[model samples]
Target: MKITEKTNEGLKREYGIVVPNEDIATKVAVKLEEIATKVSLPGFRPGKAPKDLIKKKYEEAVSSEVAEEEINKAVDQIIKEKSLKPAYRPDINVESYKFGTDLSFELSLEVIPEIEIKPFDNITLDKFVVEISDKEIDERIEFFANRQKEYKNSDSQGPVKTGDVVLIDFVGSTGGVEFKGGKGEDYDLEIGSNSFIPGFEDQLVGAKVGDIVDVNVDFPKEYHAKDLAGKPALFKVTVKAIREAVKVEINDEFAKKFGQESLESLKKMVRESISHDYEMSSKMALKKRLLDALSNEYDFEVPSKLKEMEFGAIWKQIEDAKAKGQLDEEDKDKSDEELKAEYQDIAERRVRLGILMAEIGEANQIKVEQKDLNKAIFEEASRYRGYEQQVIEQYTKNPRLIEGLKAPIFEEKVVDFIISKVKLNESKVSKEEALKKEEEANEPAKKKAAPKKKTKAKKEEE
Candidate 1:
């Protein structure tokens, strides 16, 4: 085996590797001998086939496999000897290869840039803490009570009105032909909830009990069901019953409906839920500001390959949003090139932060463990309520999903460690103020004006 240095540049290394034909022939012969023992041949007992015959049968396949293995081994040896931390898979170009000839290939790889971990004690970040007041809890309870509004039979023998729940049987047809999923029986629909097709509920406002009415409606152009979208449909509806809504009193019985012991317990749960939300928002906001500060502090060459990968992901999402006409207002006026330039900076920042965070985590020996993963997985599962086991099972069986969770969890752990070491200038803020702070943390990225091609970007002021 022979290796030659082709190129040595910043974050990029290229090498030319060669393996002698004897080495390749040796491995192929050894592989064929192993195969000969297990493989049966015509009129030949297992393990009794001639080396020439075995070579004749499997030489090409074995040679290719041997070449690939040799190349991979050589690449690994190069990385090990050079102490290289590749940003992505090394690109292999086989210039020459044959069964009985020397094999040579060019290997090129981008190494991750070395980052110097800086002290974080001097950096002061505002930690917004919002107090969950009793009034707020009461307001949330009131909202829940409103959502739990009970309906009873209307006393007045009058037509259905808004805020009334009605039971109806209907068959919706377009062009006198009934469509799939257009029929329902004794379905409870709350008028003015807008849960049904637009104008479909409004037409039922004046419908009385036992009234068989013909309601005509046009589905919106952007409706989820493509077949029914922008199409006119007539529904032959029979009013079954009308029930007026009454608010459920926020008391013990109301609390029991949610499986809570008492009203106090329910309020406690609400307060905890609100507290968790505010704390999460605070941490997120603090993380953004910290990352922004870190980006400002650290200036290093990012692996161009990583930057390109990140940019590809961001541009794909941007392209999707643009196609949907949902591009951000700040981005709407910018050309694709301009947006690319701006978002390239963002991608650079993200890659920089990720690299910095990873280095810091490694320096401090921070790691994600099985328990951490289990907790995160269980927390995710809890979000789906009754389908917790199914969600857990899906995540447990899917290694890719588990891999996805590892990074964020590790990032969170890294952030926590950083917060512990840094100066957190805690500020007690109103929930709205805290939210505004979170939004402001992102303002820097949106406000940065990226320079055109071949021009250096202006540094964002802290």
Candidate 2:
């Protein structure tokens, strides 16, 4: 076997490899001998086939298998000898291959870039701290109370209005023909909820009890029901009752309903929940700043193969969004070429940042513990409610999904490790202020105009 470097540019490496015919012939012969010990022929007992007959029968199969095995072995040797970390599978182009002839091939691949670990301690980041106010906790408690609020028949003898829950029997039709699932009896619908088809609830606004009215609406183009989508329908509605919501008092009884020991305990839990949310938001903002800082500090070349793969993934998501008519508002006006160019740059940045994060994790020995992974798996499974076991089984069956879960866990662990090392200046701010700052930070930076030099006359006048 012989190997020679064909090209070496940045992270890309190409090699030309040649394997002597004898090596391949020997491999084929060994494979044929192995097969002879198991295979049976028409006129021979099992394990008693003639060697030439076995070779004649399985020569092509054995030859192809041998070629693949040899190529893999050669590639492995090259990788080991060069200490190369490939970003993706190396592309093997067969240059020459025939039975009893030398096997020649070109191996091309992009190797992972060597990233230098920057000093995390040198990076300074501002950590926004939002204190969970008593007002916020009270608001959250009120939110839970609202969910438990009761509804009773309205006292007023008038038409329905927003915030009123109306009980009605209705039959919906398109083109004067009723459709399946278009009829409901005594359904409770909140006037302003927008739960039904667009314009359906609005048409019922002035309807009074015992009033028979026709509510007209058009199904959205993207409606879940394919048959009813984009169709205009008229619902013959018979309003049965009108009810107004009565707010539930946030007392010990209300707390007991939620399985809490007392109202104070419920408020404590709500405060803790709100605090946790704010803390998570703060951590996220800090992590973004850390990553942006790291990206600025390190400008190493990323493997083109990885960049291309990332770009492909981003483009695929964009295409999917476009197909569903959910394309980003900012991206809607951009041409395909413009979007591609913009997202390609984003993909490159992501790949570079990923490489940096991995390198940092490696340097710091950051790891995602099995217990943490189990917790993540359990949390993911819990999202499916009754189908938790099925979700768990699906994830367990798909190693790729498990890895997808692990990647974020591992990345977060690395980010935490970096955060521990960095100097975080805590700045206390209101939740609104913190959120406003986050929004501004995430917005794209506008290019600043160069300051105009004051003319001599203007300066003299001033």
Candidate 3:
């Protein structure tokens, strides 16, 4: 066998390999001998078939199998010689081949680039911190209490008003005919809630008790009921009673409704929840800054194939969104080439940062444990409400989705490790200021699927 370098550039390596015919013959003979022991022929006992007979019977099939093995070994040899890590499977180019001739081919591939790991001390970042204020906690509690507001019959028995609740009996019609789900009796409708069709509530603004009102409204074009969408309707509304609006007071009795022991306890829980939200915002802001800093500090060539793979995934999403008429406004009028060029940079950055984060995790031996995965699965399941157990069982039984959750978890751990190592200057900011800062810091990120990849054994994201 002979091997020679054909091309060596940046992260790409190409080589020409030639294998002697004798080697191919030897491999075919060995494979045929093994198959002969298991395969029976018309006139020969199993394991006792003559070599010439076996060659005649299985040579065509065995030769192809042997060729594949030789190609694999040749590629393995190239990787072994230089410890090459290919970004994807090497491309094999074989212009011609036959059973009794030298097997020659060109192997081309992009290698994973070598990344430099800068010292942790050299990276400096500002960590935003938000200190929760009593006012914020109070506001959160008030918002929660408002969700459970009560209403009572108005003492004045006057005309209905906006923000007031009304009891009504009504039948809705389109084109002088009543429609399905058109009638309600003693139904409580809030004037300003916008729960009913547009203009229905506003038209009931001056109705007194026992007054019958005809309300006209148009169902929204995007209304969920397709049959009624964009249609005009008239509702015969009867004002049964006027229910005045009421806001729940912050009291221990009110707190008990939510299972809290006292108003103070409820306020404490509200404060904790608000603090958690602010903390998450602060952490995200800090992480964005850290990622930006690390990306700025590193300069290395990423595997072109990997970048292309990432760009392909992003483009697929763009195409899908376009098909659904949900594409971003900025991308609405761009040519394919223009969109590709714009997103290709995003792809490259994603690949570069993905590689950098992976290298950092490897250098520090950061790992995602099974417990971490369990926690993530639990959190994911919680989002679906009542199907939590079913979701948990499904995720537990399906390793693929669980595996999908790992890259981000691992990236988060790497970020944590880097945060601990780097020089972090913590600055406390007001909740409003920190939120604005977070938005500003996060402005540049695409906030979508990144180029998450596992090298060698696993497939890169499509």
Each candidate's TM vs. the true structure?
0.88, 0.91, 0.82
Look at candidate 3 and tell me the lDDT of residue 313.
80
Model 1 lDDT, residue 112, Cα:
83
User: What lDDT score is found at residue 399 in candidate 3?
Assistant: 89
- For 1-462, candidate 1 gives per-residue lDDT tens digits of 899998988988999998999999999889998998888889899888887889899999999999999999999999999999888899999998988899999999988888878788978888889977888999999999878787777765548889878988999999999999999998888899999888888989888898988999998999889999999999999888897777677899999998999999999899999999877767766776777678778989888988898777777777777787777776789899998887898778778778888889999999999999999999999999999999999999999999999998998899889988889889788877777876776665543422222222232322
User: Where is model 1 more than 4 Å wrong at Cα?
Assistant: 36-38, 155-169, 175-190, 205-210, 221-230, 239-243, 447-462
Clashing pairs counted in every model: 0, 0, 0
Q: Which model scores highest in TM-score?
A: 2
Q: Could you report the Cα RMSD, in angstroms, for every candidate shown?
A: 4.6, 8.0, 5.3
lDDT of 3: 0.83
lDDT tens readout by residue for model 2, 1-462? 999998999998999999999999998888888899999899999999888889889998899989999999999999999999888899999998988899999999998888767677899999998977888888888888887877787766558888789988999999999999999996888889988887888888877888999988889998889999999999999988897778787899999997899999998888888888888878877877777777678889998878888777767777777787767676789899997887677777778878888888887888888788788989999988999999888978998888888888988888888899999899889988998998786564211111112211000000
- Model 2 Cα RMSD, 1 decimal: 8.0
Which numbered prediction scores highest in lDDT against the true structure?
A: 1
Off by over 4 Å in 2: 174-180, 323-325, 444-462
